[model samples]
Target: MRKLPAGRAGVAPAPLPEESASRPLHSVSGTPSPLPPAPRELTVRALVMGGLIGSVLAVTNVYMGLKTGLWESGCVLSSLLAFGGLSVLARRGAPPSPLETNLAQTTAVSVGAMPASAGLLGAVPALTLLGTQPPGWAVALWGVGLGTLGVLFAFSLRRRLLEEEALPFPTGAAAAELISTLHSTGSAYAARARGLWTSGLVSGVLTWLRDASQLVPPVSLLPAAMRVGGMGPETLSLGMAWNPMLLGIGVLVGLQAGLSILLGSLVAWLGLAPWLVREGVATGATPDALRESLAAWLLWPGVGLMVGAAATSIASQVRALPAVLADLRGLARYGEGWEATASRWVARAVLPVILLTGAMGWFAFHLSPLYFLLALVLAVPLCAVCARATGQTDIAPISPVGQFAQGAFGMLAPPLPSLNASAGAVVSGAASHASGSLWSLQAGRLLGTSASRQLLVQLSGLLLGAAVALPTYHLLVSVHGLDSQALPVPTGRQFKAVAELLTARGLEGLPRSSTLATGVAFALGVVLSAAARGRLARLLPSAAAMGLGFLLPASYAVTLCLGTLLAALVGRLRPSTTQTVQSAGAGAIVGESLVGVFVSALSLMRQG
Candidate 1:
């Protein structure tokens, strides 16, 4: 429902929901792994560092996601940062353990994920768009409530997805591997760390030049939009971002996702928009006119496709819901033991979720008892669908969930656009994402950590996230503004559109031609998403990537393509350089992102 571009652990972060810990097929061997006797994991030091690291990344995700719809997973990155930091010190006795590293990384992902996972990036802006902007604290509270519920949904199905199923849960596994490798090899991360830090430094400087270079005196126009050569009214305004992060993001995202983005860009910017102009459907006689035209028309198909594909994907997950419940029945009726205790803990953990569903319905959305109950009821199936999608494929198509919610509530809560959108954000934006996060949590279990402890960390992180999400959103909005030409709140804009459409007339209320076009695009998107797993799917683009391609300029998409090409070339020629290249790419993104954040602060200071 939210983001970290290029999949924080793209193939890994997604998780399934189950109560019990089943024996998953081992990473190497087919048998269940031997549960090693663990050491100190929930230490004071880990908590402090986890909180700090989580805060840093939380802010970064919020910033990056709003500026450019990219969110990086903090799991592996946080693991790298933690291991590098602790491995440097000659501690009192027993240096930091892999278990500790696991806990740190777990805490980082849990909290670091809060800002985006809470829907600050999506729902908050939509709320503003509808002219019913909530107080910052209220937004934060709502975010925390949703997060608590998401985690509960995830735990409910953890056992089935982790042990019974053989999903790799890539991000979780990668974190474990990183922790194990660092512990085993005494002094190895230095060279890699150097490469990472250096790349980041270089990237940061470059981004400053593009975004903040002109801030010397009274800042002139185009502070963020640095121009590339050959600009004219009709020259497409296709300029370079100078932000290496996009290129680095392309590398991390790899070929399939990159190519997908490029395909969508070409289709929308190069082909379709022009076709529309010639057919008199859209007018684009000048560069500015053309950009606006594409933004309006091109965005619809991208959104519709995402909606259609997600609907089909979620429908498939609904069939498996009965089995998930059946598997958990025993735990619900457990005899007294650790099993019963754990079950009780899970029950207590979910209590707030249940209570809050009603509270949010009554308080936030101002829904009647029945509507609130319906929202909770609807959330159950949607959560399952979200978790299942995350388990099978690392991609959690969040937009579809919200769109579905919008449609469902449009009829039920009719004409009240704000309530419909707000309720949808509750079900799809927050709860659905939380269920998907369990996919990653189950991975933590496979590595020999306690599920109960993970839940505790997650709840704590949510609190941390709640504290920061709204403030950060307001800060970004203050500096960047909600609708800046450079920093378009794409998710927010989309949500606003859904709210307006649903409230105003519903789909049937729209013109026949507009509906038909969007419907066709939606159908095509459904086909693409459903067939995403086919052998030929590798050649096709992802729904998000395609959608993003449509939304972003052709120049931006080109840079991403170039980075993807570099990774592809490296993989083919020097396979050993792949890891190094990934690190460098990641560093590039970090460096640029840090600079971007710094520039944002300067803007805020100047405003003050």
Candidate 2:
């Protein structure tokens, strides 16, 4: 047994068992087998349960991603859910093994991530904002193709990232730890299950009260409209939202991120917003009109900040590129069996993905053949880079990488804004999907499960996720259009802003002030990201979180800050219950998000 290195508070407080050195690592092209060569590994029951849980998580993520540009992996949560469900359904024979649970959770996590990979959240909505909404079938094909490509990319790199270098993919490690603990004792499993259910139920009820029944409304922290410097009343979009999901996100992200979000909210809402109103840069009659107008203008700098930070971070990794290339060349010359083996696997995977993605691109977005070839070439290295980033930082740089793709296509591809968004979606979706799959593989590596089996399960999960997620996305869009306040789609707005700026008629397209703000925010993001590990790191804000604050309402930032403060208090006051606190937070996120989706469907039915 061994303890994981101290991670961020609330991530993995429990110790994890180390795998035996005697056990051989599975090859990239190997078939499925139990670690002990006795108990079951890939069972039909596990796949079914995982698909069911993953289907639910897919819907939950779609709603959450559209509302806030954030979503969970659902690995740990699904593991817990599968453990409890399988325990009840098991026959008189042996209960589900840890390896079985790991496989199930892998499936759920894969399915859960399909919404983002399918571009339902960011790229697709950005195109929708530009008056282009593709059919649901196209969306499904796009998601499945890119998602499968990501899995293959991760499969090719697993040995390098997971076994050879041994980077700490924290989420995967946490899931492994939880699985080990759950199977080892009944008491531990019961405690976690109870906490999850209790929190989820409470959060669901609150969501019902707030959104469905309208008994609870967000309270404005300040006056809705406040006159400043003797100018006309400036509408302040500041409030305490009745949002448990934001609170849960705050708890998960911790203090540093929360502080950064708060800083950006104050700067954007209190300072820049009022300044814009006073200068007549943003003019609207009522508070609603004013809020919308301000958001329209502020998204540019926000996108710039996010894009700049991502670029700087990716640039910093240039030093590792040569070493990675050298290793690949060495493997090829030595005739290591795995290289040729992975080549065959990748070749088999790429053809179908290319065919489906090509069809979707041509039918839905009118993308050129160059786009497909470029995205395919870009996806390989980008996936590896994203996987490495996730391993090192436990935060996949999906949006930044996507933004990078957008910039590349902007210069090279045709000047159509929808084409740019679609290209970004293809690349970013593949990166995000690959990184998440790698996390599951990391957990499988620890649990002595077959990587090949896990890969197959992940592929199945992707198909299941695409089938379920696309319909859910369409339903939500049909009921409450993409532009509704209920689904602000911050990242989507960012993509729209970038596409416009890139395709626009030079600087003459947007307001000069907005363009200038983009430049300044981009520079700030670059600086902040570059300085993150410097001596003054403790004093620096999170560039990404701060950028996100500019895109969301002040209420979201405030609520996230409050959640962060609450988490801190819990950690300080009752340290023993930290894990329970984490579970509660995760449960609330899933619960509220699920309820929100349900409410949207209910609204649609009522209208019908």
Candidate 3:
């Protein structure tokens, strides 16, 4: 066991024999923290800051997901963004309470995850490819409606997953750690926040110089993008972002995931790409042409390995699902009828929104009533599955689940496949993704915060995120078509390809090579999951990440690895400063991301 925190004068609080390390480290001495409790929580400042931060993150997420087929943890990013903003408020005679901070984070993460959930760049574009371009209002409506539905189901899950099942929501735990550390211990975290701001400032300026260099030609001299071949679409390029965020993230994810990511980068860039080129598996005269060809081929295997690994990891936990569901039986009854009870919360407050959401899908998207109802029904179980997956790995394959929903609905509404795709993605993808965010709230539940408050914040942020993200999605699409290399909405491509293939060729349509790759990758995914139990797994790279590395250009992946290697070197040399370095890195990521958004907006305005 680790050393217990000292209570007073060399005395340590003894832990109970039944206590396990699985519990949060917050219980340092098997006792409540002595920090003064917040008298008032759920402040206006928290809501405003959370919404603003979430909107920024939503835009960033929408943009990044289109490019990378991945999203960062809202809990981590939102916590830092919120704290950095709120600390300024604290200095101006308006310090937020700890509970308020948690509430803000609840809102931030919920909405920050909105773009991916709402399928803005994922399933929505799949519909676009199949002759359906939903208006901005429909996009907003789908996002909020489905997200609220997810929130309702999430309420039912808290007891089952948190209290009974005791699943570890990794990202939520991270937020709680940040919240408790800052509010309780305070000084250590305050200094760390300084590192964040400092790095963010530097990253922001560098991003501006890199992205806006066309306007100021002198700035173009800076090494923003490192391209090896003819600086064209098919170049063997590198994104030398000059953004320190990757290094900081490396520090936080730790040496194992870091090294794994690094290894994947090397394997792809140093070994795989060249091998493919030599064998004529990937052929191009210029680097740019070859990369485009390579990415097309690589995405199949990459997605298969990644999703397969994640699914297999979740599947391994199936034994616990029955127990989790069984635990929910006791918590379903309402206390004393008319008087609202914990059990009746969903029935009384949420059922109306759900009904309205379904109606919206039926009317606006032209989804059949039966299919809409089916989607909602399926959402409950899938949300549960996603929530658990999120708790365990912080990686819920919501898009895949949504795609599954699409297939089910497509079978029923064979003629209007696009409509069914939209319904499935909105219902399953957005809702389940929203449900995954609930695990962050579970962290506050452990600390005795109000679940209702968390729900309020989440719903509010959901609205804000939907509003911002939908319009942002449209703007990005207008500027750079989804098919463009600069904005390759990969998940959307997957959805489109599947929809087209199923519609045209049916089962026989799947390419032989892709099927073979998927099978091999699936087996490897299972193998990785089996090997994931031991401490040595730390050195193991994520099968999903490696899969992504395969899809993305080698330069970007290699740069990411190099950043982490720098983090490893720092951790080895001056371990104490690693946290600070990580904060700086996280800040740099945000800073650069925001700058990218700004530059994109500038270009859009000029074009308009």
Best by the TM-score measure: 2
In candidate 3, the residue pairs with backbone N, CA or C atoms under 3 Å apart (3 or more residues apart, or in different chains) clash, namely 234-287, 234-288, 234-289, 235-288, 245-585
Please, what are the lDDT tens digits per residue for candidate 2 over residues 275-352? Answer: 897789987777789788888888878877888888887887766766555543443232134345544666566677
- After superposing candidate 3, which stretches have Cα over 4 Å from the reference? 1-38, 80-84, 90-94, 214-235, 238-290, 320-343, 363-366, 403-424, 431-436, 498-503, 506-512, 534-536
Candidate 3 C-alpha lDDT tens digits along 157-188: 77666666566676666566666566666575
Sort all candidates by lDDT, best to worst: 2, 1, 3
User: Using lDDT as the measure, which candidate wins?
Assistant: 2
lDDT of 1 by residue, 1-608 (tens): 12222223222221222322443435465666654333566676776677777776777778767765667657767777777665554265557766566667767776766765566667667777778766666566667777777776676677677666645556656666656667667654665577678888888777777778753321122323443222231333344455587778888888988998888887876667656666666666676775666576766776676677777787778778887767545445432444457667767656666676556556655656677667666776777677777766766656567667777877777587777767777776565346435644754664555666666677777788667656667776877777556566677766766777778756764433456667887788778877876886776668767777776666667788888998899889988666667778878877776677778778899978
Q: Worst 10-residue stretch by lDDT in candidate 1?
A: 11-20
- The global C-alpha lDDT for each of the candidates, from Candidate 1 onward, is 0.67, 0.80, 0.64
Clashing pairs in 2: none
Q: What TM-score, to 2 decimals, does candidate 1 have? A: 0.85
After the best TM-score superposition of candidate 2, give how far the Cα of residue 388 lies from its true spot, in angstroms: 1.3
Off by over 4 Å in 2: 1-37, 218-234, 322-343
